[model samples]
Target: MDNLRKELLRPSAESKQEVSGKVVSYFAILLIGGLVGTILIFLTVKGIALFTGNHFSLREFLTGVNWQPGHHHFGALPMITTSFSVTVFSGLVALPLALVVAIAITEMLPSRVYKFFQPVIELLVGIPSVVYGYLGLTVIVPQLRQMFGGTGFGILAATCVLFLMILPTMTSMTIDSLRAVPQSYRQASTGLGATRWQTISRVILPSAKSGILTAMVFGMARAFGEALAVQMVIGNTTVMPKGVMESAATLTSVLTTGIGNTVMGTAANNALWSLALILLIMSLAFNLLIRLVSRKGVR
Candidate 1:
């Protein structure tokens, strides 16, 4: 009778556990959704306040070059150009190098060697952004100053720092993508008389295209959103940079520098919110692109 009672209660206990687990999961999901919705609403309202409340022309804000908050000139074109330029140039420099390193680790290195290096890549990712910025400010800046001219705070310097910052992420993701290619695919490629290099270049890389693209987009997002490291190297100048070597401000750098000084509810403050909104929108776009690539990969 005791054993019979225990057995009868077991199923009920299991059912209760399942119910509790599902409740917790649903609660977490709702919590995340609520947080995201709140942020979107707040940023949207504050971002458009500049245009609606202050009556600033949206066209001029998007296309204008001037950013003098004191004189009420709030054109954001220079910051926009600088942000995109840095993100692109950094990704261009980092992606190929990351690809090469990832291939070497995934396809070339012994299993033990690869295991040893995995933590090293993770360590690079874990390093604080401020550390990278300090290194760039102290090391890369001086070298650039010696090689070229000016204060060595410009798009080039920011790009160099961001390349290092994003490299580990890209490399790790690329390695994972390449490794995800089926072993049978490699065996079949080689069985068909393809050399190892040919197998990797033709079969493996093409198969991992979507994953690599996703990695690249993630890297671009990181590069675009980075503030401290970039702010440290970028000169924070409001003018349109004529060249890579010229000092200029990115949207993030400007926000970090200017947000603290301005009074709330002013046009200057709303302008910063607009910049934040731009960043938020771009971040969403990157996430959407990743999801699209992933869906295509699944198909």
Candidate 2:
């Protein structure tokens, strides 16, 4: 009788476990969905409120080059252009170096050397943005001033600092992507009398192209969204940049600098909120691109 009771209780316990797992899974899904939905709703409502409450036209907001709050002009074309220019230039500067470093670590470096340096490379990711900013301000800015003869604070300084900040991310992602390429492919390439370098360049790289592109996207996104470090170096000028050495302001920098200064519900404040909305949309677009690329790679 005791054995019979134990058997029945075991079945009941198993059923309970199954039910609990289902409940937990559903709860987790709901929790994540709720959080995402809340964020989307909030951003959407606030962005719309900016236009509704302030009577700002979206076209003028996007096309306006001047961003004077006191003058009642809130053109963000300059900021938009600066943000794209800095992000693109920084990514361009960092991507090749990152790829080379990643390839060296995975393909050329000895196991011991690779292990010793990989952690050091990753440690860079943990360094505060302010530290990078300070370093750029103290070290890089002065060098630029001496060499190029400007205030030493401009798009160049911002781009260089952003390059350093995004390098670790790009390198780490590229390394992982390269490593994920099947060893079988490398072996087959080698078996076909291809040189190691040729194999890596043609076979491994092509196989990992999607991931490399994803890494570049992520790096560019990091460059685009960076605020504190960039604000510290970029001259924060409202005008469109005339050259790489000229003063410029990014969307993020403007938002950060102006948010506290503007009164609530005012047009200036609403414009800043609009900038926030633009950043959010940019991030979402990058994320969507990454997902599409990843799916295509998998297929």
Candidate 3:
């Protein structure tokens, strides 16, 4: 009878343990979902309040070029164009170099050489944004000014700073992605009489396409949202940039520049919030694009 009772209690204990695990998992899911939902709702409500309280027209906010709050003009086209241009140009400059560095680390360099240098490269990631901004201000800006003759703080300056900032992130991601490719694929390519370069170009890279693209998207996102570093170097001019050497303001720069001085609930404040809304939208769009690319790669 005692032995029978022990067996019965053992099953009950196992069942209780399983129930506790399920409960814990469900709680975690709910917590994460609630946090994300709350953020979305808050941004939406604050963004809409800008239009309702300030009576600012959505069309003018999106299309107008002049952003002088003193004159009651709140057009943000110039800032939008500047931000887009800086982000695209920076990505174009950084992606190729990042790819080359990643490939060299994984394929070309000796294992000991990579081990010695990997930490040095990753150290770039730990450096503060303010430091990057200061270096750009002290070094890059003056060089550009002397070389091209503008304020020296223009799209070019910003692009150069952002390229350096994003390079570590892109290269790190690319290296991890390349390393994740199955070794069997490389062996198979070699067995088929393909050279090392051919295997890398034809097999490994194609297999890792999704991850590489994801790295690019992440780099672009970083460039898009960068504020203090880019702001310090980009001259902060509220004009549409006509050339790469022209000074310009990005959406983040405008927000940071104006938010401190403007009164809460005013039209100017509301417009800044609207800019925040645009930033959120762009982030979501990039995330969606990454998911689509990943899914296609899986298929």
Candidate 4:
């Protein structure tokens, strides 16, 4: 009787063990998706890069300073300049405004007012960039064209459009960061006779430094990599940006223009891939810096 009961219980226990093991295996597979995706994408892009005369000699590409791919003189500086100028300009325009707006929303406003404004800010995030470009095309581009006297679509117009496009993202991220800090810090400062402004400026801002940097750097990457809205507003000039009002071409724009026009195995294709590789590296560096800063901030 004892042997019969033990044998009957053994199979049931084994069945339960098998089912549990299968469920655990299913979860383990799902959790590794990020690593698998990154590996796959890296392999794909690298393979494409290798086929396009991938070499270490980017001297002509980076230092030659001309970038007329039709004539085979592919200096990337002009495109880089356009990219740098627009991103820097966008950062300058958005940083202070986003910071102020985020601070107002998170710390200064009454809860009722912040609640009212929150939906509008969130809605702005989902608005299509093309719609923003269309508005720039109709309103900002024409206004700038009249004031600056050229194709209304220029670096100035691109910067303004990108600035508006990136604003909500930056502010939302900054607000999250501000809210992450402990309330006790604020209360302690208040108890010590600090004004609300002083408490925020002295105790809160410094403590939230890494969060703030993360937001701006993310905005920088978005502004730098933006293509469609930028191409619509930017006049597609290859020359260096002469002024903020001047037209310029960026790395993303170059990639866009070359996609259908350039041959697959040619130097032009290689150049575009090289430019893409550089952009990827730049974005990676920005993210790493954010991580480093955030690590240091964890006091």
Candidate 5:
């Protein structure tokens, strides 16, 4: 009897130990993944620094306007300006339209309308980025050419293309967020003598505010990273574009097409690498800001 009791207890103890080992294994996997990611990021930055031997001077980066790589000039004012301008204008064009559509679909419209529109929305999402770029080049550039000095390629076209690209993301996010707003909150706002517009502008939007911001940020990031479409439409003019009509090149376009296009050992290659680093930093900062905002609450 004693031997049988001991055998039973031994299996129970071994089972518990096995479960504990699995739990620890899961945590160890998480730890290892995080460490690998951190190490890779650190090494990338360190490698760039070591390879260039260029001091990471923020002042030089921010204030410089001449960004030619052949002569060791790394000014990026034009690229920064164009990227931000295109993104901001695109977001502006997309956001209100997205919000209104989301409201119409999620708030006033019947379930039937949402069902009908969901397919279209998903269809828009399925279209590739290259197609959008091609459309901008073929369709938009021709439209611009007729009226705008026959260049057909400029920031204006890029902005319009970006607007179309950004709309789907903004609308999808907005619809999801707006739909998630508690019905009770809407009803309570209505009960408190608030008009529909007042209720929507105040209670409902505030509830979905974080999601809306996320949508905008995501749109901006998407616009920033968009190389093909904007590259196709924007004239690739190295000089800052004079108004929306002129051609302009972006960091991505510059990096891929500049002197680095051929043999290495040249100034353009170094400059292309530097431009890439700058762009990477910008991308990283935007992602970091999103995380910080998410954790600390957007102020």
Candidate 6:
């Protein structure tokens, strides 16, 4: 009778609800995992078709400087080099400035000023990439021509445009990172007789290092993936750049400009797929790096 009474009083409906919730959660996870796996497999198959189907030497594909697809020359080294150069140069220019702005908004400024600045930075992120590209074309290119001489379409022009495009991203993310540093850290530093600058430099910044790195990685990813804007200012030249001011092509610029012109299953199409595969791999690498950094930070 006691057991029967206990069974009668039990919340069986709660257990059923819990089981349903778990089922839904597991379904969602599996669905997403399957989608990602399908995409990866598709890209891998298509990308490798360039080498396997076309019989193009992988070494030549990577190291060759010429990219005349119609004539059977498909050296991608110039585009690869230019991509890295632009990504690196833009990140170099944007990171320090972003750090300064983030610190000012998060740590140094008054709350009201911080509020005002935060929305402004967010606004920058919402602006269309084409608008930025147009501005670079109309305003930045001519200025560069006057200041440095050249057609103003080169690695430097692309770098400047990317710098502006990425600055807001880095700054907003850094601000969130700095703000995520516990108030206790600041209190502890102050209690230890540290000055404001010393506390921020030694305690807060160090604590937020992983997040800052993640922001920079994300910024680099954005710069690397950008196509239309970069193509507009980068001169879309297929040759290796002799200098920052010389016309150069990036993987994205080449792919965007040429992909639509080629027929399906052709070497040209496969080559573009290879470029896209490179981009996918880089994006995965960045995500993996962020996970590693986050794990280390937790440890």
What range of 10 consecutive residues in model 4 has the weakest lDDT sum? 47-56
Span of ten consecutive residues with least summed lDDT in model 6 = 290-299
User: Each candidate's TM vs. the true structure?
Assistant: 0.96, 0.94, 0.93, 0.85, 0.83, 0.94
Candidate 3 accuracy as TM-score: 0.93
Predicted structure with the largest lDDT when compared to the true one? 1
Full-model lDDT, candidate 2: 0.91
* Clashing pairs in model 6, backbone N/Cα/C closer than 3 A: none
Q: Candidate 2, residues 62-168: lDDT per residue as tens digits? A: 99898898888989999999999999999999999999998988888887877887798789988999999999999999999999997998899999999999999
Model 4 stretches astray by more than 4 angstroms:
1-57
Model 6 compared with the native: what TM-score? 0.94
lDDT digits (tens) for residues 1-299 of candidate 6: 99999999887998989999999999999999999999999999999998999999999999999999998898999999999999999999999999998898888889898889888999999888888889899999999999999799899999999999999999999999999999999999999999999999999999999999989988998998999899899999999899999999999999899988999999989999998898899889878987888888788
Ranking by lDDT: 1, 6, 2, 3, 4, 5
Q: Give the alpha carbon lDDT tens digit for every residue of 1-299 in model 3.
A: 99998877776767889999999999999999999999888888777765787778889888989888877788889998998898999998899998998989988888887788679878998888888999999999999989989689999999999999999999998988899999999989999999999999999999999999989989899899999999999988898788988889999999889989898877777778888888888989888988888888788
Q: What residue runs in model 1 are displaced by over 4 Å at the alpha carbon?
A: 1-11
> How many Å off is the CA of 282 in candidate 6?
1.0
How does residue 163 of candidate 5 score in lDDT? 88
When 1 and 4 are scored with lDDT, the better candidate is: 1
Report every candidate's CA lDDT.
Answer: 0.95, 0.91, 0.89, 0.82, 0.78, 0.93
Tell me the tens digit of each residue's lDDT in model 5 across 201-228.
Answer: 9999888887777777877788887877
Local distance difference test, candidate 3? 0.89
